[model samples]
Target: MLKTAAGGSFIIEDTTEVMTPDQLTDEQRMIADTTRDFIQGEVLPHDEQIEKLDYELTVDLIRKAGELGLLGADVPEQYNGLELDKVSSTLINEKLAKASSFALSVGAHVGIGTLPIVYFGTEEQKQRYLPDLAIGTKIAAYCLTEPSSGSDAQGAKANAVLSDDKSYYTLSGTKQFITNAGFADVFIVYAKVEGEHFSTFIVEREMEGVSIGPEEKKMGIKGSSTCPLILEDVKVPAENLLWEVGKGHLIAFNILNIGRFKLAAGSVGAAKETIELSAEYANERTQFGRPISSFPLVAKKLAEMNVKTYLLESMVYRTAGLMDEAMREMDNSKPDAGVVAAKAIAEYAIECSINKVFSSETLDSIADEGVQIHGGYGYIQEYKIERIYRDSRINRIFEGTNEINRLLIPGTLLKRAMKGQLPLMEKAQALQSELLSMVPGRKIEGTLEQEEHLIAMAKKMFLMAGGQAVQKYQMKLEQEQEILSHLADMMIQIYAIEGAFARTKQLIEKRGEDKATIAIAMTEIAVHEAFEKIEAWAKDILATMETGDMLRTQLSILKKLGRRTPVNLIAKKRHIAEKVAYASKYVV
Candidate 1:
C-alpha cells in the first residue's frame, strides 16, 4: 500500500504515520532514502575532494544517480523516467539538496537544463535526446546566460543566421557560466535569430565549431562543470529547433518559472539538512557542563530555523501540488495544449518568484546560523557547514536574483489586484472585520480604512514609477518594485494568518471544539501579529504620501492597531517548532 504525506495521499506503515512521514509517497520515500544513503555513504566522505573538482568522481556519481533514477524524475515512461508529477520532482530536488553542490548538478540536469525539450520538443527530439538524459549516457547543459545578458537575457548577442537553403541555422555566440559545459553531450543553445526573435537549438558535441572553454573556478558548486560554450558558426538542423521560431522566450520563461520553484524546493532540502546537522552538533557539543542544545539562545535559533523551514516546505509543496493538479486537468493531447499549459505555467511567475525569494533567504539565514551553532568548526573546511554556507549564497544570485524576484512579487500582484483578479485586500478586510467582531472593543486600528488608503498610495506610486519597464537596459522598476514587493510580503503574512485560523476552526469543528486550544491560541497570535505588521507597512507608505496633520492621522491608526492585540507569538512559534521538530519533517 502507498502512503501519502502533507496534503497528498499515500500509504506507509501505521507507526510511521504517527511520526508524520506523510510528506512522501512510498515511492518518493524510497527514492529519498536511497539518495540520502548514497550521499551519506559515498558523497559526504568525498565531498571535500569533490569540491576541488575531481572530474572522475563527479562523473561516476552522476552515473550512480542515474542508476538510482534521480536523473530522470521528469522524463516519460518510454524514456526510462518515472513520469512523475511536479510534486514528486520537487521531492527529488529536496532530497538532493542534502548533498549541496551535487544537488545543483542533478537539479540542473533535470530542471532548467533539460526541461525545455521535455515540455516543448517534438516526438523525434524526445526519442533522440531524453533517453541519454534519463540514463546519464550523455550529459546535458542549458545555454542562456552570457557575459552581458545576466538579467537582460532577451538582449542575446548570439546570432543564429539562416542558411542559404534555409535548412539550418548557423549559430554563432558564447554562452557564459553554462552548467555541465565541459562534458555535456547536448546543449540547449538560445541565440538571436536574424529576423529579430530569439531561437533555441540543440547543439550537440559532435557539431562543428561547438567547443567549451576551460572550466572557470566558481565561488561554489565547483564539482559541477561550469564554463563557456562557444558556437562559432555551428550549424544546427532545422528539425533541431525547439518549438516554433521566435518562441524561445516562451519556452525560456516558462521553463525558468518551473526551475525557480524547484530551486525553492531544493533550498528547503538544504535548510533541513543544515538544521539536522546543527541539531546533531548542538546535542553533542558541551557548554556549561551540558549540551549546547540546552542553552536557551542556541535552542531559540534552532527553533526559529525549524519554524521557517516548515513554513517554506509548506509553501513549496503547496505550489508544486497546485502545478501538478493544473497539469493533470489540462488536455495534453490537444494540438495547442502544450502552449496553453505553458502560458498558464507562466501565470505562476509571482508564486514561483515568491517561493524562490523566501526559500533562498530562509536557507541563507539557516545556513548562517547553522555555522554559528557549530562554533569554530563551522568556518573550517573539516565541516560541511563551510561548503553549505558557500553553496547556499549562489541560490540568491542565480535563476533571477532575489532583487529581481522581489520586484516581480509586487509588480505581479498589483497588476492582478488592480484588474480585480485577486481579492487579497478584500479578503483581508473581511478577516479583519470577523476577528474584530469576535473581540469587541479591540479598536482594530489600521483596518480596512487604512488598507483603502494604502491602495490609493500604491496606485500613485505605480503611476509615479510609470507602468513601463523603461529601456531594455534601465531598471526603473526599482522603486515600484520595492513598494510592491514589501506590500506582497505583508499580503502573504495576512493570508497565512487567515489560513491558519481557518484551519484551526476546521480542526476544532472536526475534533470537537474543546480540543482546539493550541491551534486556536496559535491562530489568534498569528492574526494579531500579522495585523500589526501590515498596519505598520501601510502607515509607512502613507507617511511617504502625506505630511503633518494628514501623516499624524494615518500614523495614529497604525499605533492603535498595535495597542492591545492578544496572542504571544514567541510562545506560539516555540510550540509550532516543537510540534514540527518532533514530527520528523514538514509536519506543520
Candidate 2:
C-alpha cells in the first residue's frame, strides 16, 4: 500500500507511488489491443453511418462489443461478466473512445445505466438484470436528470406513488437528456416516492405507460440514443426499488464517481485519437515545400497535446490504482463486497472530480487545435475533427458540468477535513504558523526533486488560500463560488502535475533514467507549466480575500514559494514532439 492521506488530503500529502501505463500487465495490454482492433475493424468502417443517426447499426455494434466481452469488465462473473479489475474497465472506456458516439452508447449502458444495479440492487435484481446487461442482450439507460433538474439532481419533480394494494409503485415523470433511451430495454429511473421521498426504481421498457419521446437532435454523438423517457403511472414492482428509498442520492452520487473517472479515461482516449489525427494530417500536408508538422508552431501544438494527454492518462490510472488498492483492502469474502467497492471508489471522489474537469478541458483543447491544424477542411462535416470537436463539447457539460465539478473538488475536501477524514485543518493550522516564520532560501536538487518540492509548495499555497477563505467566509464559504473555483483550479493543477511527476519518477526508478528520458521531459514540462498557473490562481484568490499590506505580505510568500529558474520548455517540447511526430501518435 502506498503511504498517503485518506480522503482528499493528497492535496497536502506527499505522493511517492502512482501506477503508470508503462506498468500495464501483458493481459491488460492484450485487452487494450483487442479493443483498438475491434474499433478499427468493426466500428470505424461504419463511423459515417453511425454519425448519420443509424440507430440499428449502432445497436448492432454494441451487441458485437458485448459478444467480445467488452461491456462487462466491471460486472461480476456470476452475472456473465468478466469481473475484471477497475483498470480493465478504464482501459475499455479509453479504447472505446476511438468509436466516437458509439463509445458514448456503450459507456452509458455499462457505466451509469447498469452499475446502479451492480452496486446497489438486491441479489434478485442483479440476477434479473445483470446477465442480460452483461451480455448486451438487453441494453440499459439511467434516468436522473430531468428538464428542471440537472446539477441539482435531487431537486427532480418526478414522482412515484405506491399503489393501495402495495403490489406496485405508480411512477409518473419525464427524464430529459437520457442517453441510451431509444433502445435500452431496462431503465433506472429516479423519482420522489409519494411525491415526497426521492428514490430510484428499475422500470422495463415494455411496462405499461412507459414510453420514450422522439430522439434528441444533439450537437454531437448523434448515433448514441438521446431522448426523454416518459413514465406515466408506470407500475414498478416493489422489488424494483433500488437500494433504499430516500437514499437514492447515495446511489446517484456514488455511481457518478465511477462515471466521472471512466469519462476521464474516455476523454484521454479521444484526445489520443485527435492527437494522432492532427499529427498524421500535419505530417502529410506540406506547406511552402515542407510538411507543416516541420513548422515550430505546429510542432508545439502537437507536443502540448501529447503532454496534456499523457498527464491525463497518468491521473486516470493513478486514481484507478488507488481505487484498486482500496478494494483490495476490503474483505471480499464478506457479502457486502459490492458496497465496499462502491465506498472505495467514493473515497477518491475529489480525484474523480479533478479527472473529469481536467480531462474534459484537455480534450476540448485538443479537438479545437486539431480542427485548427486541418484549417478549412477541419470545419467541414466530412472530416473527423469537426465531429470530434463537437463531441468534445458535451463532455464538459455532462457528467456534471465542469463548473459543478470544480466547486465539488474544494468543497468536498473541506467537508472531509471537517469530518476528520483528512488532516487538512491540522495541516493548515501548522502551515499557518510556519508561514509566519518561514524562510525564503532553500536548496534544490535534480529536476525531479525540484518538481517534487514545487508540488509541496503548491499544496501549501492551496492551504493558505483555502484556509484564509474559510476563515473569512466562515459558514458562508459556499457562497464564495469564485474563491472555491480558484482553489479547485489550484488543486487540479497540483494533482495533474503531482500524478505525472510521481509516475515518471517510478518509471525512472524501475527502468533507469536513460530509459525514462521522455517521461522525465514530459514531467518537467508539465510541472513547470502547471506551477506557473498555480502561482497566478493563488494571486487572484489572495487578491480577492486581502488587500494593501496584508495582500502584499501574502503575495510575497506566494512569490517565494513559486520562485524557480525557468527552463527551455520550447526545446523540451521540441524533443517530445520529435518522438510523437516520428511515431505519428502519442508516443509518451
Candidate 3:
C-alpha cells in the first residue's frame, strides 16, 4: 500500500519499471504512423509554398487533413469525430510538430480554437458548428487575445452590450494575432458584458459586420494565418453564447490546458524532425575529412537533442494516458458534466504546464543546435533550420507565456495539496523509500528523502507566505519567475516518474519482469535525474529567499550528499534514436 503525506495508504503501485514497443496498443502505433506519413508525404513537400501564405493551397490541404481524420481527433463520434482519446490526440500533435511552425497552425486550429466548443458548447452549438469543423468544412479560430491584453486574456475590453429584449448582444472589438483568422468560419470570442462578467460568444463569419484584416507578418510560423478579427457591431443571438454566461474562463482555461499538453507533444514532433534533419546532414556534410556528425561537439549536440526528445516523449504520452484513464472514470454525459470533468482535468494542469515549458525550451534549443551543426548553411534560408528556428520562437511566448505557466505550476500544485488531490508528502516519501529499498543504488543515497521533505516544506512555505509574498515580494517573485518555472518542471518530471513507475509495476505483474527491463532502465535514469534537478531547484529556491549565509552552507551540504550514478547518456540516446529511426517515426 502506498501512503501519502497525511499517512493514508492507497493501492497505487510504483511505476518506475521499463516498457517495450510491444507494450503499446496497435491503435496508438497506428495513429502515430498515420501522422508521420502525413507530414512526410503531404506537408513537407508544400512547406515552402505554405510559408509564403498560399491561403488557398493551405486551406485545400487543411480540407485534405479533415478527410484524413487528422482534424477533430478529440471531438466525439456523434459530432463527426473519431472520438479518439487524449493519448491519440497527443501523439498526433507530437508528430505534426516535426513539421515545425506548420505544426503551430495545426495545434491552434485543433486544440485551442476548436476544443472549447467540443468541451463546453450546447448541443445546438455543437451540431451547428462541430461537423464542419471536425470534417474541415470550416476552419476554426480562437479570439481571446486583444491589442491591450497580451497575457491577461480575461482582461478583454471587447464589450458585448445586451439588448433590452435579452435577445442579442452587439459585439464591437478587435481580437489581435488570431491564428487562422482570415480563413476560419467560426470563432470563440471573449468579451466583457456591461454590468456582467467576462464571457465567451460563438461568432460566425457569415454574421453581419464581421471581417478579418490583413495577416500580421510574424516572427515565426509564417505558414499559419494570423490576423486581427474586426467585429464591427456584430449582433450575435443570445443562443450563440457558449457554455454559461460569465463562465468563459472555464472554456478558456480548460481548452488552454489541453493546448499546453498538445504543445508539448508538438514540440516533441519538432525536435524529432530537427534531429532527423541534423543526423542526415551530419552524416553527409563532412568536415576534417569525416562527416560533421562525427565531430565530438556535433555528436554531443545530437546526443543531447535525442535525450531531450526522449524525455519529452516520455512525459507527453504518460500524461496523455493518465488523462484518458482519468476521464474514463467520470460521467461525461450530464449537463453539468464538464464541471466534474473540469475537476478531473484540472488536476493535471501541473503536468500540462510542465510539458509546455520543457518541450518548448527543448525544441528551441534543439533547433539552435541543428543550425549550429549545419555550419553557416543553417543561417541561409535554403536550409530548413532557419525557418524551424523562427517558428519555434513563439511557442514559449504563446499558449500562456512560460511566465504565467510558472506561477500556475506552483499555484496549481498548492491547490491540489490543499484539496488532498495528491497524497500527502509523507505518502510520497514512503513510496520513495520503498523504491530506494528495491533499487539499492548510490543514486538513492545522499538526502533524496530530505530533498523530498524540503519540497514539501517549500510547498508549506509558499502557502503560508504566498499572500504576503505576493504583497511584499511581487517584484521579487516576478524576477524569480524562472525559479517557479524550474520548480514546475521539476514537479512535472517527478509526477511523470512516479506515474510511469506505477505503470511499470502494473506491467511487471501482468507481463512479467523480463519484458519490463527496458522501461526499468528508462525509469531509473529518469527518476535519479529528476531527483537531482528537484534537489538543485529546491535548494536554489531556499537560498534565493534567504538573507543569510546559512542557505549557502545548507545547499553545499545537500549537494555533496546527493551524488548520483553516472549514466552513459550517449549510449542510451543512440539506442533510443535507433529504435525511433527503425520505426521511422517519433518513438515518444
What is the lDDT for 102 in model 3?
64
Candidate 1 per-residue lDDT, tens place, 285-351, comes to 9977987876767766776776566557656765665566556667655555556666656766776
RMSD of each: 7.3, 1.3, 5.6
Candidate 3 has an lDDT of 0.70
lDDT scores of the candidates, listed in order: 0.69, 0.90, 0.70
Give lDDT tens digits, candidate 2, residues 140-240: 99999999999999999999988899889999999999999988999999999978888999999999999999998888888788999999889899999
- TM per prediction: 0.82, 0.98, 0.83
Give the lDDT of residue 160 in candidate 1: 89
TM-score, predicted candidate 1 vs. hidden true structure: 0.82
List residue ranges in candidate 1 displaced over 4 A: 1-24, 331-337, 417-479, 491-533, 556-566, 569-588
Query: lDDT score of model 2?
Result: 0.90
Better of 2 and 3 by lDDT: 2
Instruction: Give the clashing pairs for model 1.
Output: 2-10, 2-11, 3-10, 3-11, 3-12, 4-10, 4-11, 5-22, 5-23, 410-484
Q: Which ten contiguous residues of candidate 3 have the minimum total lDDT?
A: 2-11
* Clash tally, candidates in order: 10, 0, 22
Off by over 4 Å in 2: 1-5, 331-333
